[model samples]
Target chain A: MGSFVQWLIESMFLWKALIIIVIFAITLAIAAYSTWGERKVAAYIQDRRGPNRAGWGGLLQPLADAGKMFFKEDFIPAQADKWLFILGPCLSMFTALMSSAVVPFGSSFIIGGKEVFVQAIEINIGILYVFGVVSLGVYGVMIGGWASNNKFSLLGAIRAASQNISYELAMGMSIIAILMMSGTLSVREIVLQQHGGNWNIFYQPLGFLIFTICAFAECNRTPFDLPECETELVGGYHTEYSSMKLGFYLFAEYINMFASSAVTACLFFGGYNYPGMDFVERQLISGFGANAGHNVATLIGIGSMFTKILFGIFFFMWVRWTVPRFRYDQLMNLGWKGLIPLAVGNLIITAVAILSGYKLVGIWVGLALMVILISIVWSLRPKKKNAIMGA
Target chain B: MQNILNLPPIWYTFAILSVLTLFGALGTIMSKNPVHSVIYLIVTFFSISAHYILLNAQFLAAVNIIVYAGAIMVLFLFVIMFLNMKEEADEMKNNKLVTAAIVTALLLGGILIIFLRRAGKEKVDALGFNSQTGMVEILGQSLYGEYLLPFELISVLFLVAMAGAVMLAKREQGERHF
Candidate 1:
């Protein structure tokens, strides 16, 4: 069996296809289980016993959930756009899967006297591929909302559109800070940029904060889940959907969660890097077995990345349970009135810093500007006496 | 079969693209509804974009999808839903619409066939793009360097569109007062 595996690895085309399939399966499976994890996290946070009955510590809960969703009845409302209703989820799932194509899982390792890379597909516009894919995520919600033949669904879709559009601006702007610091848009390059103790969180702490907040808003997690506000919209855009159709929406959300977490890990948390990673590999592992176990080092890099992603996922769940959901108007107000201006300011600061060669001073100045802006916003708010009188 | 699959990359892509193009254009017209038409148009755009990707004109394809499908189709859907014009009216001259669509389809198909025939005579590119990069850097460099005028013009065009939309949606004060 080991020899067969070795032979399979030696064949390039066969190995490529196998690797692609494995990556797809692993990503999708992680996304699937994240849904169960989210529920368990929420339950634990709320002081309730979680899904312990499915398997040992509810290890098989996600499988049971998938089974339940599959067995449930599928329905198409008489007035719904049947074609679009189908197309919506397909778009969501397709775009959700597309962005992972360019991410480098690990550094290259030697195979058959030649170096072999572990990335799925290396493209020059790696990050732009992500931008494109993320933009397409909007279509799923928009189409699903429009096809539901219900007012609530339409409203939910509209909210999703407006919220996404608003946040994408800030999100893009937040990215400018990273792009300036890293000097490249390639995810692998960005990871390489943070190879040491100099993770981007040190250089661009405010940018990290802004980007993390924007990530929440972009993924439509609480306190930004205005699109799926249960109290007002009655299940929001998926109100009329049942069975796998409903499962598709929920599944897409989880995939989106994973994807966003992956992006966050890549951008702010040094991607697949840890402090002293190279030092440890060079000093200790390089000598072991005449460096024959190089794959082990690569494995460590890959595992570090996945660990960061897992932490990101946990953070998403933690925030979801801890923070109350934003009201619709407040969501809009925060997105447009607050984040947009701040993002634009952040972009200007980043640009000026890059061009002016005032690395430390420029950043501190930017931070001060951000503080002033926030203080101005606070000062502009109505006093309690005036607010009470007006009310 | 293996040899066919292993054909030179350009020709392989070209053959598949031609088939997809034919199917897409055919499906666009043959479809009964505007929704279907738009969806088919998206597929057509995507196939064309893939062809662009093959040719290493990645920028053009990205713009093609972003402008035509992403921006334009959404507006089309908005208008259709707003007007609630989901289906053709029974009282309408169905033959007229059908004939008009058919004639246009035929004319387009004929032109494309002629173009394909001519293109077949030209030297096929067996190699050119070796390293693939996203179009953004290339497009950005070109736009700011050689194509600066056109880039500025596009910005102006966007501004004009914004102004036009505002003007069209605006409530006339004269009418309101009256």
Candidate 2:
């Protein structure tokens, strides 16, 4: 027991534990409030005043929403599998929350002459850890759909399962290009490598594009949200769910969005690395001494990281509202035929470029390849029948 | 009490995980519903992955969950759901089949026991248990260096299997050959 306590103290300081709890709470709060953000964004886009009744500009809207969910009568279908019906949302929320553990929000800062890494956990295989959990999240959708005992729900769940699995291949392949360039799997290491404005986006812009698109598909966002298309499958897998159980599914999606955005920022954009950060750091160190300046720099990094995450979320919302959902066939074709082949080609080009010691040229090559591929896909795409000249 | 307290946390975790894995495996075999069986199998895989974590094989642990619990079990669930399998009735019991099952179980147990006995005779890897063993870099180096041929061969095997699966699933134009 003493040894365990000693180990815990050594491995995780009181400050670290507090930071983790704070981050966890913040993540949940963000996910809860993101619903409000989404509605507000949608309303703004559609030209309306969105939910301003709960508080000043609907600041307390999420709380009211939570309360409503709590007060609402919970309903379960008569033929539903009780165990799996409950397990579904719990699994979704659990996996969604777990994926955030690997993300590095900021660089290390000195506290009591010891360096503290500002993230929940530091694992060597951080990227893979997130991928594994995200992949596991599909089970929640599958189980929920199956347990619902509704045909629509079942179809939606199967579609979601296949969709997530298919997109994950492209996502993983695209990430391979980033991994090759960064030469590390640890999220912190990747972020650190991107310090002083050497963000991975510059080197692997094409990879980033592929990753972002695949992320949308993986998250079941925007044009890729065929699984739960309201015009077809009514509420999709959550058709039978009511009250907090339903809330959990929605909340899980938001959390997944937040986590994936953070992951993208960490992978592509400079995670916490701001441009001219070294110059600022040096100036600050000379002006205000080392430790204090370092603390300030760390704060700035955290701020920058959050900014990137917010923008990423905004991009998700913007795309969601702007782009119409793809047909089911188009979704599969884009994933399997479009992204996978492009990702593989990009990865091969990256490898060859690395081998030949022409890393900068590799980025241009990747961009050219992506453009060519897109054009090829565009030309080959089955043309939509003209409305005036009926097919 | 002092000795119990002095034991490392990993031992306690290992004991709990081992028991859980065994229970999950039993449930997998004993569950009447195919979906329930698949879920139990997933639980078993998860516990085994927990064991992998305890052994400091973090990469293996993650891969195990991703491959077994995530992908493979999902496919299993999909199949069971697609079939819409219900609880099976006890029928078509044959003496020969029962005898064959018993013999197979006995043989498997004997082989497992022999392997365990042989393993027990060797020195433990405790002295060589470096935390870095599980890092992606080390794993990649070893896999690409010493295990390159085997890895390539396995990838080729997977490609073949995938092609076979695609072919099997493909619809035939000429008379719908089974």
Number of the top-ranking candidate, with TM-score as the measure:
2
Q: Give the Cα lDDT of each candidate.
A: 0.78, 0.88
For residues B1-178, could you state the per-residue lDDT of candidate 1 as single tens digits?
8988778878977998979988989999888776567667777888998888887876677667655665566556555544656666673468888888889999999999999999989865558643444466766776789999988999999999988987997688776632
Residue-level lDDT of model 1, residues A46-143, one tens digit each, is 99877899889888999998899999988889998898988777787787787777777777665666566667777666776676667667778878
Model 1 residue runs over 4 Å out of place are: A1-11, A373-391, B1-9, B25-32, B66-72, B87-136, B156-178
TM-scores for every candidate against the unseen true structure: 0.83, 0.93
Candidate 2 ranges with C-alpha deviation above 4 Å = A1-11, A369-391, B1-6, B87-107, B128-131, B174-178
Q: Go through the candidates in order and give each one's DockQ.
A: 0.25, 0.74
Error of 2 at A301 (Å): 0.3
| Residue pairs with backbone atoms closer than 3 Å in model 2 (clashes) | none
